[model samples]
Target: MKIGLYFGSFNPIHIGHLVIANHLVEHSDLDQIWFVVTPHNPFKKKSSLLDNYQRLEMVYRATKDYPKLQPSDIEFNLPQPNYTINTLVYLQEKHPDYKFSLIMGEDNLKSFHKWKNYELILENHHIYVYPRLSKGHVETQFDNHKKIHHIDAPIMELSSTFIRSAIKAGKNIQPMLPQHVWEYLDEMNFYK
Candidate 1:
């Protein structure tokens, strides 16, 4: 099986995420997409993040109906400030028969060289880049690389930060999130 590891903070999984995942499964060679929820992204601020379990649950609720999509807490068991290279290596060892690819946005690809052992990741795994609005057109050194593929998936300007801010401001965010996720957030009084 070819699995695409779509890593994110998923402070609250939203529609943009769903759209991207669905698009990848339908249009790419990926057999499945695992939403690898990062417990602590080195690039992000830990103080602004919700609990790992909460974020994982919201992802689960949002993607439960899609068999091709799964919510994974793989990084939670790994070290703090999880690095992509380590996770990929561990996954390869545990699931030797399954091939894994990295799925990310073009904005992330623009700064991917700064990631730990990024060159090793590029050499070993396939990378699928999806477009994100307002990031501007970024041309990478590896644009012509065979292992790296740029996909024309639908772009959404929506972000978890925007959703959280809307909720905190007492604004309606039902349209931004999955129905079940919105209900879960309301029931738990999250992000308010």
Candidate 2:
């Protein structure tokens, strides 16, 4: 099986996430898309993130209906300050038959060189890149890298940050979220 690992905090899973994952899975050869919910991202602040289980629950709610999309808590058990290389290695070890690729934004690709053992990662797995409205430049080497593919997926500017802020400000962020995720957040009174 060809699985695309779409890693994120999913502080709350929103529509933008679905659209991109759906588009990629449906358009590409990937058989499934896994939303690898990170327990801790070295680049982001831990305090701002919700509990791991809560975030995972939201992901479950958002992706339940989509058979092609599934949520994974693989990072939850791994050592904190999670790194992509470690997860990739662990996954490869467990699922030898599965061809796993990365699903990341073009902005992340720009900083791909800075990741741990990035060279090794590039050697082993393919990376599917989506467009993002961020400012930065991709390294010249990655521009034509065979393992890195830049797909013309829709540019979804809606962010979990924006949704969280809106909910805190008592704004209606329902439309931005999957119905069940919104209901889950509302029922739990999260981000308020």
Quantify all predictions' global Cα lDDT against the true fold. Answer: 0.91, 0.91
RMSD (Å) of each candidate, 1 decimal: 1.9, 2.1
Question: After superposing candidate 1, which stretches have Cα over 4 Å from the reference?
Answer: 41-47
lDDT of 1 by residue, 1-192 (tens): 999999998999999999999999899999999999988555666676888899999999999999999999888889776689999999999999999999999888888889999989989999999988764676878788889999999988898999988999999989999998999999999989
List TM-score per model, in order: 0.94, 0.94
* Residue pair clashes in candidate 1: none
**Would you give me the overall lDDT of model 2?**
0.91
For model 2, residues 1-192, the per-residue Cα lDDT tens digits are 999999998988899999999999999989999999988655676676898889999999999999999999999889877789999999999999999999999878877889999999999999999988766654656998998888889999998999888988999988999999989999999989
